[model samples]
Target: MRRWTPFVLLMPFQFIFGLIYSWGTISPAIHVQSGWPQATLDLAFSLTPLGLLPAVILAGRALHRLAPKTLLAWALTCFTVGGGIGLLTASPVAFMLGYSLLALGVGAGLSTAACIALVSRLYPQRRGSLGGALLALYGMSSVISAPLFDEINRLIGWRPSLAALLAVYAAVGWLAWAFLPEAPAAPGRQTAPLPLMVLLRQRPLRWALVIVLMATPLGSASFATIGHLTKAIGVSSALGVLAVSLMALGNGVGRLGFGLLADWISPRFSRAAALGLNALAALLLLGVLHGYGVWAFVAYPLLIGLAFGGMAGKLPALAAHVAEHHGEAAFGLLFGAFAFASFLGPFLSAGLGMHSALQGLALCALAAMGLGLAVAR
Candidate 1:
């Protein structure tokens, strides 16, 4: 079971991971098809993280009772049904509702954390390596899916493209059911989840979340508005779309690399490096604004994606350090904070404008980095 369950489970979760971040790729199609305003489209897309937040919290709570098969079952059902609704419905209300259900399936319900938790149990000693591999795979979906979505939506259109993915995921999910045997429990798997209040009080996790809150806006903003970045530099939309894929590739690399770095070195070093990368990316964005060169536009996502992906990649230890045996749930709380980034990124971009938004992000990174200097009593 341990020899192959991890590989068996990887396929379905990879498909789910792509869905969470597909907004940047497909939002333009929905906007064009529905004639919806950008704000309305943003709201509908942002529901992904919003939906993921509460569902992850609940999934963490239910870890004790839910069998792996049962959880995987709900994850598939919710995702496909919701995706079906979103595909068929032209109505805004219906689309939003379906997207929310998709979010539920993939969040804590049957998503990344659940699958990663299973693997963590499977290879307790190699949890970091395996978990980071999973995260990198999660990043790979965006790499392939972005350009795939861009081209397919251009050809058969979003409806058929979405339908095609749903079919593929269903087939892969069947493999998970047949081959994903129940993982034996980890040695201390029964430890109680830390109280939310207590979880919040830990210095490492607290500063990490604060870092997530502060640093994410820049990366999120870049991702959400990537097309505009290319446009500003007088480049083609094709390049803009391709930039997204590069960002995804960078994301995968960053997550895998930093996770191993944390294992090889220390969480503090990995975390600080991620923050520095983000701060540097923010500065690079500022330079892009002055029309430095087209390469800056290309480098932006790759660099920032590394930092942004590293932020989460380096954290399994930090979360485990704070919450003891309940790292999955602790990680859930960290995941939820990105929901705020979805809203804040756009708000900052709109209110503060592009230049100020990046500046704010730079300041946020510095603020988070300074936490390392504070005396821990």
Candidate 2:
């Protein structure tokens, strides 16, 4: 394979996100149009992560044995079908199922299995930077998706916008599968399949896992909080929408910026600082939640956005390190476990509610900080 082949493969990956997850930015608008309460939309959004749990674990195992490109292509097809189903129908159950399908495809194909394979095999020297750039690209989807979807929904409604996304996911997946080369399997350098429990037993490994788990609530709190701030702070819906784009910008910046830091500094240091910043950001939210207009409107998203965004690039690098320290075979399982935590964070944060979630997430951040310190030491 040419050296630049993997980089080219990233295009479809970015496009899938632009269509699928980016659609999330317009979720608020969808809520209004469907006559469904925010809770219903939350329920639908929640399905993605929830559905990811088994999907990620299973995908990891399958990729260990099968060709990743083939699997990715099939998963992308599933994503298209799932997304298509949800877009065409307004049934709450159907919508949730569609999201679950998309989640399954993404979890199995994009987020865990294919991503790990791509970075670990192709860009060994530039792990942090490459991973961060990839994640940052994913974050950019929100910026592109939010206003684009908002405009699309205005013109044709949510259903058509979703259907358009479904088409994109399908096309991108097919192109990637057709062209992306499979890395040749190695001999002798074998990994033993360790159970999740055994992998979690190592202290450093546990801390690394905890970092992702801890990050989940932090990221989720931010996602749910957008609407809350609009209501509580009395910001114009326009400003609230703008905040979402800013958050996406912060997310991309964090991924690329912190990722570069991870390469220059130690992953341990980069992760610890990120978690501490997360704690501080959550604290900032708590302090400013009651403040008027600008502070209430601007402060939380800016900080939370940075903290959550920074984690994407760093976490995978951290995971790879932890896996290297543990064993290579353990990488898939450990990452799967981490994905489980990622899935849990949003719902847990949502359950924490507007005001209280910040405090709970702050504690999680502090705990992550502690774990990070232990890992560093």
Candidate 3:
């Protein structure tokens, strides 16, 4: 078990991301099929982040009630069952309810508690790279699932495509139940008081919050808007979808590649570099609005995916550094607080009037980049 710890640690995240996160790509399709105008569809897509607010606030205590393995198993079952419900009905409202339920389970179960807790303790030196690698694996599921879901739709239909997704979730759950390790409870507040105000008073935490607020909106907006940008820039819908596929692939690559890169460079450097890339990515995205032809399709998502990946890869290391520096006793509380920022990413992106949000996104990314460098120094 010790020899296989890393693999076991990462399995739960891979499953959760594969099911819920991948749906961003499918969101437009859901919108079109459900007859909800693009506005409603976008709103529904952003709900996961809204719902995550309360869920992340309470997640540490929720994980304490059961072993991480038990909690993960139950979470995966909820995800599978919710996905199965999605298959049973075609009503857009029904689909929204089903996906939201899955998203809720994902938010609670996939918190920093399990993987971060386990790996940071077991392999403290490698936590950054390991966490990044795990996130990358999560990204891979999106890459693979995007095209697979498309192919599944082509062959069986969306309903069965969802049913198939349920099977995958179930299989991953069983693997988690069978293999994920149970860590000995570390010294900390077993029931840490949620310090909503502590974060407000702490300068370091406030800085971390600013980073997430910036990067997450950048990460999510790029994801949400890439399809629209492609079409508006004159790529056909077919090509827009193709660009989305590449974006997903790039997201995974960013995670894995940058995770490894973080191992080599200082976490501070890794973060600053990520912020810089995000600024560049934002410019590329803004350029697309000017009609860059097929080149825009290739350039924008690639840059966005890379910057988004950099942010994802750097987070675990950043969080772990704060935890170790402040006192591991309060790690869960600190991590949960940091996660609250992740919960805001999608809403920030969508808040930009659906038409010109990219400009706002670029501005936000630049602000985040500047903050990251300051915080690192």
Clashing residue pairs found in predicted model 1: none
Please tell me which model should have the higher TM-score, number 2 or number 3: 2
What digit string (tens of lDDT, one per residue) describes model 3 on residues 1-377?
56666566566666554455666656655655556677766655655545444443445445444455555555556566666665577666665666664544344334444565566556667767887777677666665677777777677756677567667756765666566666565444365533547534666656765676666566666676666666656767887877776777777778776766667886667777778888887767666655554574466677778777767776667654544443332334434443444445555546655446667767788888788777774
- For model 2 the local lDDT of residue 300 reads 62
Query: Which lDDT value does model 2 have at 324?
Result: 66
Higher-TM-score candidate among 1 and 3? 1
Give candidate 3's TM-score. 0.80
Q: Estimate each model's TM-score.
A: 0.85, 0.85, 0.80
Q: Please give the TM-score that candidate 2 achieves against the real structure.
A: 0.85
**Looking at candidate 3, what is the lDDT of residue 189?**
36
Which clashing pairs does model 3 show?
none
User: lDDT ranking from best to worst?
Assistant: 1, 2, 3
Off by over 4 Å in 3: 5-9, 24-40, 61-66, 84-91, 103-112, 187-194, 234-242, 286-298, 325-355
In the range 1-377, model 2's lDDT, one tens digit per residue, is 48878767865675564344564655666777778777877677666655655565666555555555665665676676777676667687787787554634353434445665566567766767776787777667655656666777788887787677557657766777677777655222255345567766767777666667776466656765676667766777887887776776777788777777777886776777678777777667656564633565466676667777777667556666666633333445544554565556656656666666666766777777777766684
What's the C-alpha lDDT at position 184 in model 2? 56
RMSD of each: 3.2, 3.3, 4.0
The global Cα lDDT (0 to 1) of model 2 is 0.64
The order of the candidates by TM-score, greatest first, is: 1, 2, 3
Clashes of each: 0, 0, 0
- What lDDT would each prediction earn against the true structure? 0.68, 0.64, 0.61
